[model samples]
Target: MAREITGFSNPLVKRVRSLREKKLRKREGLFLAEGLRILTEARELGVLPEMIFLASGADPHPLASALINAVEAAGGDVIFTTPDILGKMSGKDNAQTLIGVYRDRLTPLPALDRARAPIWFVAQAMRDPGNLGTLMRIGDAVGAGGVILVDDCVDPFSVEAVRASMGAIFTQTIAHASWDEFLAWLRAGPGQLIGTSLNTDQDYQAPAYVPPAFLLIGNEARGLPAGYEAACDLLVKIPMLGRADSLNASVAGAVMAYEVLNQLRRTGDQGTAPQAPE
Candidate 1:
Protein backbone atom coordinates (compact mmCIF):
# COMPACT_ATOMS: atom_id res chain seq x y z
CA MET A 1 0.00 0.00 0.00
CA ALA A 2 1.19 3.54 -0.75
CA ARG A 3 1.39 6.31 1.81
CA GLU A 4 -1.06 9.14 1.24
CA ILE A 5 -0.14 12.77 1.78
CA THR A 6 -2.36 15.85 1.29
CA GLY A 7 -0.24 18.85 2.24
CA PHE A 8 1.89 20.89 -0.12
CA SER A 9 4.08 21.62 2.92
CA ASN A 10 5.28 18.03 3.12
CA PRO A 11 9.06 17.59 3.44
CA LEU A 12 9.28 14.78 0.87
CA VAL A 13 7.34 16.94 -1.56
CA LYS A 14 9.84 19.74 -1.05
CA ARG A 15 12.73 17.35 -1.62
CA VAL A 16 11.27 16.06 -4.88
CA ARG A 17 10.67 19.61 -6.09
CA SER A 18 14.17 20.68 -5.09
CA LEU A 19 15.64 18.25 -7.59
CA ARG A 20 14.86 20.91 -10.19
CA GLU A 21 17.77 22.83 -8.76
CA LYS A 22 21.19 21.65 -9.95
CA LYS A 23 22.91 22.20 -6.62
CA LEU A 24 20.22 20.34 -4.74
CA ARG A 25 20.29 17.49 -7.24
CA LYS A 26 24.08 17.21 -6.98
CA ARG A 27 23.84 17.21 -3.20
CA GLU A 28 21.09 14.60 -3.18
CA GLY A 29 22.62 12.39 -5.91
CA LEU A 30 19.12 11.99 -7.34
CA PHE A 31 17.05 13.52 -10.14
CA LEU A 32 13.40 13.80 -11.14
CA ALA A 33 11.70 12.02 -14.07
CA GLU A 34 7.99 12.40 -14.69
CA GLY A 35 5.16 11.05 -16.86
CA LEU A 36 3.86 7.48 -17.15
CA ARG A 37 5.85 6.74 -20.32
CA ILE A 38 9.17 8.00 -18.98
CA LEU A 39 8.78 6.29 -15.66
CA THR A 40 7.66 3.13 -17.45
CA GLU A 41 10.83 3.17 -19.54
CA ALA A 42 12.91 3.56 -16.42
CA ARG A 43 11.22 0.56 -14.84
CA GLU A 44 11.62 -1.55 -17.98
CA LEU A 45 15.26 -0.54 -18.15
CA GLY A 46 15.81 -1.91 -14.63
CA VAL A 47 15.90 1.50 -12.97
CA LEU A 48 13.61 1.95 -10.01
CA PRO A 49 13.00 5.36 -8.56
CA GLU A 50 13.80 5.87 -4.91
CA MET A 51 10.27 7.20 -4.54
CA ILE A 52 7.15 7.63 -6.63
CA PHE A 53 4.46 10.28 -6.12
CA LEU A 54 1.07 9.45 -7.58
CA ALA A 55 -2.11 11.54 -7.54
CA SER A 56 -4.43 10.11 -4.96
CA GLY A 57 -7.80 8.76 -6.19
CA ALA A 58 -6.76 9.25 -9.78
CA ASP A 59 -7.11 6.44 -12.26
CA PRO A 60 -3.73 4.75 -12.50
CA HIS A 61 -2.07 3.90 -15.77
CA PRO A 62 -1.69 0.10 -16.05
CA LEU A 63 2.06 0.55 -16.46
CA ALA A 64 2.07 3.00 -13.59
CA SER A 65 0.44 0.37 -11.38
CA ALA A 66 3.11 -2.13 -12.41
CA LEU A 67 5.77 0.44 -11.59
CA ILE A 68 4.33 0.92 -8.10
CA ASN A 69 4.38 -2.83 -7.51
CA ALA A 70 7.96 -3.22 -8.73
CA VAL A 71 9.03 -0.26 -6.68
CA GLU A 72 7.36 -1.54 -3.54
CA ALA A 73 8.81 -5.00 -4.15
CA ALA A 74 12.23 -3.38 -4.34
CA GLY A 75 11.65 -1.54 -1.06
CA GLY A 76 11.06 1.78 -2.75
CA ASP A 77 8.42 4.20 -1.42
CA VAL A 78 5.22 5.18 -3.17
CA ILE A 79 3.45 8.33 -2.01
CA PHE A 80 -0.09 9.18 -3.01
CA THR A 81 -0.71 12.90 -3.06
CA THR A 82 -3.30 15.44 -4.14
CA PRO A 83 -3.15 16.63 -7.75
CA ASP A 84 -2.18 20.13 -6.58
CA ILE A 85 0.76 18.73 -4.67
CA LEU A 86 1.83 16.77 -7.73
CA GLY A 87 1.56 19.94 -9.76
CA LYS A 88 3.63 21.83 -7.22
CA MET A 89 6.34 19.19 -7.23
CA SER A 90 6.55 18.94 -10.99
CA GLY A 91 6.18 22.71 -11.65
CA LYS A 92 3.49 21.95 -14.20
CA ASP A 93 -0.09 23.17 -14.05
CA ASN A 94 -1.14 20.09 -15.99
CA ALA A 95 1.39 17.69 -14.49
CA GLN A 96 0.98 13.97 -14.98
CA THR A 97 -0.32 11.96 -12.09
CA LEU A 98 2.94 10.07 -11.74
CA ILE A 99 6.40 11.42 -10.90
CA GLY A 100 9.56 9.62 -9.91
CA VAL A 101 12.76 10.54 -8.15
CA TYR A 102 15.53 8.46 -9.73
CA ARG A 103 19.22 8.14 -9.07
CA ASP A 104 21.43 10.02 -11.48
CA ARG A 105 22.98 7.53 -13.94
CA LEU A 106 25.75 9.59 -15.57
CA THR A 107 28.87 7.42 -15.79
CA PRO A 108 32.54 8.29 -16.04
CA LEU A 109 34.06 8.18 -19.51
CA PRO A 110 36.48 5.42 -18.59
CA ALA A 111 33.56 3.27 -17.49
CA LEU A 112 32.03 3.26 -20.97
CA ASP A 113 32.27 0.09 -23.05
CA ARG A 114 33.07 1.74 -26.40
CA ALA A 115 32.72 -1.63 -28.12
CA ARG A 116 29.26 -2.16 -26.67
CA ALA A 117 27.66 -0.60 -29.74
CA PRO A 118 28.61 0.40 -33.29
CA ILE A 119 28.14 4.17 -32.86
CA TRP A 120 28.08 6.74 -30.04
CA PHE A 121 26.96 10.37 -29.80
CA VAL A 122 29.20 13.08 -28.35
CA ALA A 123 28.32 16.70 -27.48
CA GLN A 124 30.55 19.54 -26.32
CA ALA A 125 29.45 22.51 -24.21
CA MET A 126 25.84 22.11 -25.25
CA ARG A 127 23.88 24.42 -22.96
CA ASP A 128 20.31 23.64 -23.86
CA PRO A 129 18.78 20.78 -21.94
CA GLY A 130 16.25 20.22 -24.74
CA ASN A 131 18.98 19.87 -27.36
CA LEU A 132 21.02 17.61 -25.12
CA GLY A 133 17.99 15.45 -24.46
CA THR A 134 17.12 15.23 -28.16
CA LEU A 135 20.66 14.07 -28.90
CA MET A 136 20.22 11.29 -26.36
CA ARG A 137 16.99 10.37 -28.14
CA ILE A 138 18.95 10.21 -31.38
CA GLY A 139 21.55 8.03 -29.69
CA ASP A 140 18.73 5.67 -28.82
CA ALA A 141 17.38 5.75 -32.38
CA VAL A 142 20.77 4.95 -33.91
CA GLY A 143 21.44 2.12 -31.46
CA ALA A 144 24.54 3.97 -30.33
CA GLY A 145 26.53 2.86 -27.32
CA GLY A 146 25.57 6.00 -25.36
CA VAL A 147 25.79 9.77 -25.27
CA ILE A 148 29.18 11.19 -24.34
CA LEU A 149 28.77 14.75 -23.05
CA VAL A 150 32.00 16.69 -23.44
CA ASP A 151 32.87 19.68 -21.30
CA ASP A 152 30.40 22.03 -19.59
CA CYS A 153 27.28 20.61 -21.17
CA VAL A 154 23.78 20.88 -19.73
CA ASP A 155 22.96 18.52 -16.87
CA PRO A 156 21.40 15.46 -18.46
CA PHE A 157 19.50 14.92 -15.24
CA SER A 158 17.63 18.21 -15.49
CA VAL A 159 13.88 17.78 -15.57
CA GLU A 160 13.77 19.70 -18.85
CA ALA A 161 16.26 17.35 -20.45
CA VAL A 162 14.63 14.26 -19.04
CA ARG A 163 11.26 15.47 -20.29
CA ALA A 164 12.75 16.37 -23.65
CA SER A 165 14.26 12.91 -23.96
CA MET A 166 10.71 11.54 -23.94
CA GLY A 167 12.02 8.47 -22.08
CA ALA A 168 15.16 8.10 -24.15
CA ILE A 169 16.80 9.20 -20.93
CA PHE A 170 16.21 5.67 -19.69
CA THR A 171 16.99 4.05 -23.03
CA GLN A 172 20.46 5.58 -23.52
CA THR A 173 23.63 5.44 -21.44
CA ILE A 174 25.04 8.87 -20.56
CA ALA A 175 28.62 9.87 -19.75
CA HIS A 176 30.40 13.18 -19.22
CA ALA A 177 34.03 14.39 -19.24
CA SER A 178 36.21 17.31 -20.23
CA TRP A 179 37.52 17.58 -23.79
CA ASP A 180 41.05 16.56 -22.80
CA GLU A 181 39.74 13.66 -20.77
CA PHE A 182 37.41 12.41 -23.53
CA LEU A 183 40.04 12.82 -26.27
CA ALA A 184 42.69 10.99 -24.28
CA TRP A 185 40.26 8.15 -23.57
CA LEU A 186 39.25 7.92 -27.23
CA ARG A 187 42.89 7.88 -28.34
CA ALA A 188 43.60 5.03 -25.94
CA GLY A 189 41.03 2.92 -27.78
CA PRO A 190 40.07 1.79 -31.31
CA GLY A 191 37.30 4.35 -31.85
CA GLN A 192 37.09 6.85 -34.70
CA LEU A 193 36.26 10.48 -33.81
CA ILE A 194 34.23 12.24 -36.49
CA GLY A 195 33.45 15.92 -35.95
CA THR A 196 30.93 18.16 -37.72
CA SER A 197 32.40 21.50 -38.75
CA LEU A 198 32.22 24.37 -41.23
CA ASN A 199 35.99 24.45 -41.72
CA THR A 200 36.04 21.00 -43.30
CA ASP A 201 35.32 20.60 -47.00
CA GLN A 202 34.70 16.86 -46.66
CA ASP A 203 31.06 15.91 -47.17
CA TYR A 204 29.20 14.31 -44.28
CA GLN A 205 28.24 11.32 -46.46
CA ALA A 206 31.70 10.75 -47.85
CA PRO A 207 33.36 8.92 -44.97
CA ALA A 208 33.58 5.19 -44.30
CA TYR A 209 32.78 5.85 -40.65
CA VAL A 210 34.45 3.24 -38.47
CA PRO A 211 32.58 1.06 -36.04
CA PRO A 212 32.62 2.27 -32.47
CA ALA A 213 32.68 5.66 -34.10
CA PHE A 214 32.24 8.70 -31.86
CA LEU A 215 30.07 11.29 -33.60
CA LEU A 216 30.84 14.68 -32.04
CA ILE A 217 28.79 17.89 -32.21
CA GLY A 218 30.18 21.11 -30.88
CA ASN A 219 28.70 23.82 -28.65
CA GLU A 220 25.53 25.53 -29.92
CA ALA A 221 26.92 29.07 -30.06
CA ARG A 222 30.64 28.73 -30.84
CA GLY A 223 30.97 25.07 -31.73
CA LEU A 224 34.04 22.95 -30.90
CA PRO A 225 37.12 24.93 -29.95
CA ALA A 226 39.84 25.16 -32.61
CA GLY A 227 42.16 22.74 -30.82
CA TYR A 228 39.30 20.28 -30.44
CA GLU A 229 38.43 20.30 -34.14
CA ALA A 230 42.07 19.87 -35.12
CA ALA A 231 42.23 16.88 -32.80
CA CYS A 232 39.49 14.99 -34.62
CA ASP A 233 40.55 12.01 -36.79
CA LEU A 234 38.18 13.32 -39.47
CA LEU A 235 36.00 16.39 -39.79
CA VAL A 236 33.02 16.53 -42.18
CA LYS A 237 30.50 19.25 -42.95
CA ILE A 238 26.82 18.98 -43.90
CA PRO A 239 26.14 21.02 -47.01
CA MET A 240 23.81 23.98 -46.42
CA LEU A 241 22.04 24.62 -49.68
CA GLY A 242 19.54 26.95 -48.05
CA ARG A 243 20.13 30.45 -46.69
CA ALA A 244 20.82 29.06 -43.24
CA ASP A 245 24.49 29.06 -42.45
CA SER A 246 24.30 25.97 -40.22
CA LEU A 247 21.98 23.48 -38.61
CA ASN A 248 20.87 23.42 -35.00
CA ALA A 249 23.42 21.42 -33.01
CA SER A 250 21.04 18.61 -32.14
CA VAL A 251 19.61 18.46 -35.68
CA ALA A 252 23.13 18.26 -37.10
CA GLY A 253 23.96 15.51 -34.63
CA ALA A 254 20.87 13.50 -35.61
CA VAL A 255 21.81 13.68 -39.29
CA MET A 256 25.35 12.58 -38.59
CA ALA A 257 24.35 9.76 -36.21
CA TYR A 258 21.84 8.16 -38.64
CA GLU A 259 24.36 8.17 -41.49
CA VAL A 260 26.92 6.50 -39.28
CA LEU A 261 24.36 3.98 -38.11
CA ASN A 262 23.44 3.18 -41.71
CA GLN A 263 27.05 2.60 -42.71
CA LEU A 264 27.95 0.37 -39.74
CA ARG A 265 24.72 -1.62 -40.06
CA ARG A 266 25.29 -2.46 -43.73
CA THR A 267 28.11 -4.79 -42.81
CA GLY A 268 29.26 -6.12 -39.43
CA ASP A 269 31.70 -3.82 -41.08
CA GLN A 270 33.85 -3.45 -37.94
CA GLY A 271 37.07 -1.76 -39.01
CA THR A 272 36.48 -2.23 -42.71
CA ALA A 273 37.85 0.69 -44.75
CA PRO A 274 35.41 0.91 -47.65
CA GLN A 275 32.30 3.12 -47.60
CA ALA A 276 30.15 0.23 -48.82
CA PRO A 277 30.50 -3.53 -48.72
CA GLU A 278 30.61 -5.61 -51.92
Candidate 2:
Protein backbone atom coordinates (compact mmCIF):
# COMPACT_ATOMS: atom_id res chain seq x y z
CA MET A 1 0.00 0.00 0.00
CA ALA A 2 1.26 3.49 -0.87
CA ARG A 3 1.64 5.89 2.04
CA GLU A 4 -0.01 9.31 1.79
CA ILE A 5 2.12 12.42 2.21
CA THR A 6 0.07 15.62 2.54
CA GLY A 7 2.45 18.08 4.08
CA PHE A 8 5.19 20.00 2.25
CA SER A 9 7.32 19.70 5.38
CA ASN A 10 7.51 15.93 5.09
CA PRO A 11 11.14 14.78 5.41
CA LEU A 12 11.03 12.58 2.27
CA VAL A 13 9.49 15.39 0.25
CA LYS A 14 12.12 17.83 1.46
CA ARG A 15 14.93 15.39 0.63
CA VAL A 16 13.62 14.90 -2.89
CA ARG A 17 13.48 18.67 -3.35
CA SER A 18 16.98 19.06 -1.96
CA LEU A 19 18.35 16.81 -4.72
CA ARG A 20 18.05 19.76 -7.10
CA GLU A 21 21.29 21.10 -5.65
CA LYS A 22 24.56 19.34 -6.52
CA LYS A 23 25.90 19.66 -3.03
CA LEU A 24 22.89 18.05 -1.42
CA ARG A 25 22.81 15.31 -4.01
CA LYS A 26 26.46 14.54 -3.37
CA ARG A 27 26.02 14.68 0.36
CA GLU A 28 23.05 12.35 0.29
CA GLY A 29 24.41 10.18 -2.57
CA LEU A 30 20.99 10.26 -4.21
CA PHE A 31 19.31 11.75 -7.28
CA LEU A 32 15.83 12.07 -8.72
CA ALA A 33 14.29 10.65 -11.90
CA GLU A 34 11.02 12.24 -12.97
CA GLY A 35 8.15 10.89 -15.11
CA LEU A 36 6.80 7.44 -15.85
CA ARG A 37 9.17 6.75 -18.71
CA ILE A 38 12.32 7.37 -16.73
CA LEU A 39 11.14 5.41 -13.70
CA THR A 40 10.00 2.55 -15.91
CA GLU A 41 13.36 2.53 -17.61
CA ALA A 42 15.01 2.44 -14.20
CA ARG A 43 12.90 -0.55 -13.17
CA GLU A 44 13.62 -2.30 -16.46
CA LEU A 45 17.32 -1.82 -15.83
CA GLY A 46 16.95 -3.42 -12.39
CA VAL A 47 17.67 -0.09 -10.70
CA LEU A 48 15.00 0.26 -8.08
CA PRO A 49 14.97 3.61 -6.37
CA GLU A 50 15.20 4.02 -2.59
CA MET A 51 11.72 5.53 -2.79
CA ILE A 52 9.11 6.57 -5.33
CA PHE A 53 6.63 9.45 -5.27
CA LEU A 54 3.24 9.48 -7.00
CA ALA A 55 1.07 12.55 -7.44
CA SER A 56 -2.20 12.40 -5.54
CA GLY A 57 -5.33 12.22 -7.73
CA ALA A 58 -3.20 11.29 -10.73
CA ASP A 59 -4.63 8.55 -12.88
CA PRO A 60 -3.27 5.18 -11.84
CA HIS A 61 -2.32 3.64 -15.14
CA PRO A 62 -1.51 -0.09 -15.24
CA LEU A 63 2.18 0.66 -15.72
CA ALA A 64 2.21 3.00 -12.74
CA SER A 65 0.52 0.38 -10.63
CA ALA A 66 3.03 -2.23 -11.73
CA LEU A 67 5.87 0.08 -10.75
CA ILE A 68 4.35 0.67 -7.35
CA ASN A 69 3.96 -3.07 -6.83
CA ALA A 70 7.50 -3.67 -7.95
CA VAL A 71 8.83 -1.04 -5.57
CA GLU A 72 6.90 -2.58 -2.69
CA ALA A 73 8.18 -6.05 -3.59
CA ALA A 74 11.70 -4.71 -3.60
CA GLY A 75 11.32 -3.37 -0.07
CA GLY A 76 11.18 0.24 -1.19
CA ASP A 77 8.64 2.84 -0.15
CA VAL A 78 6.08 4.61 -2.33
CA ILE A 79 4.58 7.92 -1.28
CA PHE A 80 1.44 9.48 -2.71
CA THR A 81 1.38 13.24 -2.36
CA THR A 82 -0.54 16.29 -3.53
CA PRO A 83 0.18 17.68 -6.98
CA ASP A 84 1.68 20.82 -5.42
CA ILE A 85 4.12 18.78 -3.38
CA LEU A 86 5.06 16.68 -6.38
CA GLY A 87 5.61 19.86 -8.37
CA LYS A 88 7.86 21.23 -5.69
CA MET A 89 9.80 17.95 -5.56
CA SER A 90 10.32 17.98 -9.32
CA GLY A 91 10.98 21.73 -9.59
CA LYS A 92 8.42 21.96 -12.38
CA ASP A 93 5.22 23.98 -12.78
CA ASN A 94 3.54 20.80 -13.99
CA ALA A 95 5.14 17.95 -12.12
CA GLN A 96 5.36 14.45 -13.39
CA THR A 97 2.91 11.89 -12.11
CA LEU A 98 5.81 9.75 -10.89
CA ILE A 99 9.27 10.49 -9.51
CA GLY A 100 12.02 8.25 -8.13
CA VAL A 101 14.89 8.79 -5.71
CA TYR A 102 17.67 6.57 -6.99
CA ARG A 103 21.08 6.02 -5.46
CA ASP A 104 24.05 7.30 -7.42
CA ARG A 105 25.41 4.64 -9.79
CA LEU A 106 28.69 6.10 -10.90
CA THR A 107 31.40 3.44 -10.75
CA PRO A 108 35.17 3.36 -10.42
CA LEU A 109 37.52 2.84 -13.39
CA PRO A 110 38.14 -0.76 -12.33
CA ALA A 111 34.46 -1.54 -12.70
CA LEU A 112 34.57 -0.91 -16.45
CA ASP A 113 35.01 -4.00 -18.63
CA ARG A 114 38.31 -3.28 -20.32
CA ALA A 115 38.67 -6.71 -21.95
CA ARG A 116 35.92 -6.34 -24.52
CA ALA A 117 36.62 -4.27 -27.58
CA PRO A 118 35.90 -1.47 -25.15
CA ILE A 119 34.80 1.62 -27.01
CA TRP A 120 34.42 4.49 -24.56
CA PHE A 121 33.40 8.13 -24.71
CA VAL A 122 35.61 10.43 -22.62
CA ALA A 123 34.64 14.03 -21.88
CA GLN A 124 37.04 16.59 -20.35
CA ALA A 125 35.72 19.42 -18.22
CA MET A 126 32.28 19.26 -19.84
CA ARG A 127 30.22 22.14 -18.46
CA ASP A 128 26.81 21.45 -19.96
CA PRO A 129 24.61 18.91 -18.26
CA GLY A 130 22.38 18.62 -21.30
CA ASN A 131 25.34 17.93 -23.54
CA LEU A 132 26.74 15.36 -21.14
CA GLY A 133 23.35 13.69 -20.99
CA THR A 134 23.05 13.73 -24.77
CA LEU A 135 26.47 12.16 -25.08
CA MET A 136 25.43 9.47 -22.63
CA ARG A 137 22.36 8.78 -24.76
CA ILE A 138 24.49 8.67 -27.90
CA GLY A 139 27.03 6.44 -26.20
CA ASP A 140 24.29 3.98 -25.37
CA ALA A 141 22.90 4.27 -28.90
CA VAL A 142 26.26 3.37 -30.43
CA GLY A 143 26.93 0.53 -27.96
CA ALA A 144 29.74 2.35 -26.21
CA GLY A 145 31.39 0.27 -23.51
CA GLY A 146 31.10 3.14 -21.02
CA VAL A 147 31.48 6.87 -20.43
CA ILE A 148 34.49 8.40 -18.63
CA LEU A 149 34.46 11.85 -17.16
CA VAL A 150 37.86 13.52 -16.96
CA ASP A 151 38.56 16.23 -14.41
CA ASP A 152 35.81 18.67 -13.38
CA CYS A 153 32.87 17.85 -15.64
CA VAL A 154 29.26 18.66 -15.00
CA ASP A 155 27.31 16.30 -12.77
CA PRO A 156 26.03 13.48 -14.93
CA PHE A 157 23.37 12.84 -12.33
CA SER A 158 21.93 16.36 -12.55
CA VAL A 159 18.21 16.55 -13.29
CA GLU A 160 18.76 18.31 -16.60
CA ALA A 161 21.38 15.84 -17.74
CA VAL A 162 19.46 12.79 -16.57
CA ARG A 163 16.37 14.01 -18.41
CA ALA A 164 18.42 14.71 -21.50
CA SER A 165 19.84 11.19 -21.32
CA MET A 166 16.33 9.86 -21.83
CA GLY A 167 16.99 6.99 -19.40
CA ALA A 168 20.48 6.11 -20.56
CA ILE A 169 21.58 7.04 -17.06
CA PHE A 170 20.20 3.77 -15.77
CA THR A 171 21.69 1.66 -18.54
CA GLN A 172 25.12 3.17 -19.03
CA THR A 173 28.34 2.65 -17.07
CA ILE A 174 29.83 5.98 -15.94
CA ALA A 175 33.28 6.67 -14.44
CA HIS A 176 35.37 9.59 -13.24
CA ALA A 177 39.13 10.13 -13.40
CA SER A 178 41.73 12.87 -13.58
CA TRP A 179 43.55 13.54 -16.89
CA ASP A 180 46.72 11.79 -15.79
CA GLU A 181 44.79 8.93 -14.26
CA PHE A 182 42.89 8.58 -17.53
CA LEU A 183 46.17 8.55 -19.42
CA ALA A 184 47.49 5.80 -17.18
CA TRP A 185 44.38 3.78 -17.79
CA LEU A 186 44.69 4.26 -21.55
CA ARG A 187 48.30 3.18 -21.43
CA ALA A 188 47.24 0.06 -19.57
CA GLY A 189 45.81 -1.10 -22.95
CA PRO A 190 42.03 -0.75 -23.08
CA GLY A 191 42.41 0.58 -26.68
CA GLN A 192 43.46 3.59 -28.69
CA LEU A 193 42.61 7.05 -27.38
CA ILE A 194 41.22 9.09 -30.28
CA GLY A 195 41.02 12.83 -29.77
CA THR A 196 38.97 15.41 -31.72
CA SER A 197 40.48 18.75 -32.65
CA LEU A 198 40.04 21.51 -35.24
CA ASN A 199 43.79 21.79 -35.80
CA THR A 200 44.01 18.25 -37.14
CA ASP A 201 44.06 17.75 -40.90
CA GLN A 202 42.62 14.21 -40.78
CA ASP A 203 38.90 13.88 -41.38
CA TYR A 204 37.01 12.08 -38.63
CA GLN A 205 35.57 9.50 -41.02
CA ALA A 206 38.89 8.53 -42.53
CA PRO A 207 40.14 6.39 -39.67
CA ALA A 208 39.24 2.75 -39.17
CA TYR A 209 38.83 2.85 -35.42
CA VAL A 210 40.31 -0.21 -33.79
CA PRO A 211 38.41 -2.07 -31.11
CA PRO A 212 38.64 -0.48 -27.66
CA ALA A 213 38.70 3.00 -29.16
CA PHE A 214 38.27 5.81 -26.68
CA LEU A 215 36.59 8.80 -28.35
CA LEU A 216 37.90 11.78 -26.38
CA ILE A 217 35.99 15.07 -26.52
CA GLY A 218 36.88 18.44 -25.09
CA ASN A 219 35.07 21.25 -23.28
CA GLU A 220 32.43 23.39 -25.00
CA ALA A 221 34.53 26.56 -25.24
CA ARG A 222 38.13 25.40 -24.74
CA GLY A 223 38.07 22.25 -26.86
CA LEU A 224 40.79 19.79 -25.78
CA PRO A 225 43.29 21.12 -23.27
CA ALA A 226 46.64 22.34 -24.62
CA GLY A 227 49.36 19.65 -25.12
CA TYR A 228 46.79 16.88 -24.65
CA GLU A 229 46.52 16.09 -28.37
CA ALA A 230 50.02 14.59 -28.40
CA ALA A 231 48.87 11.96 -25.90
CA CYS A 232 46.10 10.71 -28.19
CA ASP A 233 46.85 7.82 -30.55
CA LEU A 234 45.09 9.72 -33.35
CA LEU A 235 43.72 13.22 -33.80
CA VAL A 236 40.81 13.81 -36.20
CA LYS A 237 38.58 16.73 -37.11
CA ILE A 238 35.04 17.23 -38.36
CA PRO A 239 35.00 19.24 -41.54
CA MET A 240 33.08 22.53 -41.47
CA LEU A 241 31.11 23.41 -44.60
CA GLY A 242 29.32 26.46 -43.26
CA ARG A 243 30.83 29.53 -41.60
CA ALA A 244 30.48 27.99 -38.16
CA ASP A 245 33.82 27.44 -36.45
CA SER A 246 32.77 24.35 -34.55
CA LEU A 247 29.99 22.03 -33.49
CA ASN A 248 28.36 21.74 -30.11
CA ALA A 249 30.26 19.42 -27.75
CA SER A 250 27.55 16.79 -27.81
CA VAL A 251 27.01 17.15 -31.54
CA ALA A 252 30.69 16.73 -32.24
CA GLY A 253 30.91 13.73 -29.92
CA ALA A 254 27.88 12.13 -31.61
CA VAL A 255 29.35 12.59 -35.08
CA MET A 256 32.67 11.04 -34.12
CA ALA A 257 31.10 8.25 -32.07
CA TYR A 258 28.81 7.26 -34.94
CA GLU A 259 31.70 7.37 -37.30
CA VAL A 260 33.53 4.95 -35.04
CA LEU A 261 30.51 2.68 -35.22
CA ASN A 262 30.38 3.11 -39.00
CA GLN A 263 34.01 2.19 -39.44
CA LEU A 264 33.58 -0.87 -37.27
CA ARG A 265 30.53 -1.88 -39.34
CA ARG A 266 32.37 -1.42 -42.64
CA THR A 267 35.22 -3.59 -41.45
CA GLY A 268 32.83 -6.31 -40.30
CA ASP A 269 34.34 -6.02 -36.85
CA GLN A 270 31.82 -6.78 -34.15
CA GLY A 271 33.96 -4.99 -31.61
CA THR A 272 31.03 -3.76 -29.52
CA ALA A 273 29.66 -1.68 -32.40
CA PRO A 274 25.95 -1.03 -32.39
CA GLN A 275 23.75 -2.52 -35.09
CA ALA A 276 23.95 -0.40 -38.23
CA PRO A 277 20.84 1.72 -38.75
CA GLU A 278 18.59 -0.02 -41.25
Among these predicted structures, which one has the highest TM-score? 2
Q: Give the C-alpha miss distance for residue 96 in model 2, angstroms.
A: 3.8
25-130 in candidate 1: lDDT tens per residue?
Answer: 9999999998888888888889999899998786787898899999999999999998889999999895656899998998888889887777788889999999
Candidate 2 Cα errors over 4 Å, as ranges = 116-118, 273-278
* Tens digits of per-residue lDDT for model 2, 1-278: 47999998988788889999999999999998888988898888788888999876757888788899999998998898888898999887867568999999888886677655446889999999999999989988888866899989999999999999999998778999999988887787658889988878999877778878888989999999767888998999899999988899999989988888877777777565545455
Root-mean-square deviation per candidate: 3.2, 1.5
Candidate 1 positional error at 271, Å = 9.6
- Per-model CA lDDT versus the true structure: 0.86, 0.86
Q: How big is the positional error of residue 195 in model 2, measured in Å on the Cα after superposition?
A: 0.8
Error of 1 at 213 (Å): 0.7
Q: Relative to the unseen true structure, what is the C-alpha lDDT of residue 67 in candidate 1, on a scale of 0 to 100?
A: 95
> What would you estimate as the lDDT of candidate 1?
0.86
CA shift of 33, model 1, Å: 0.6
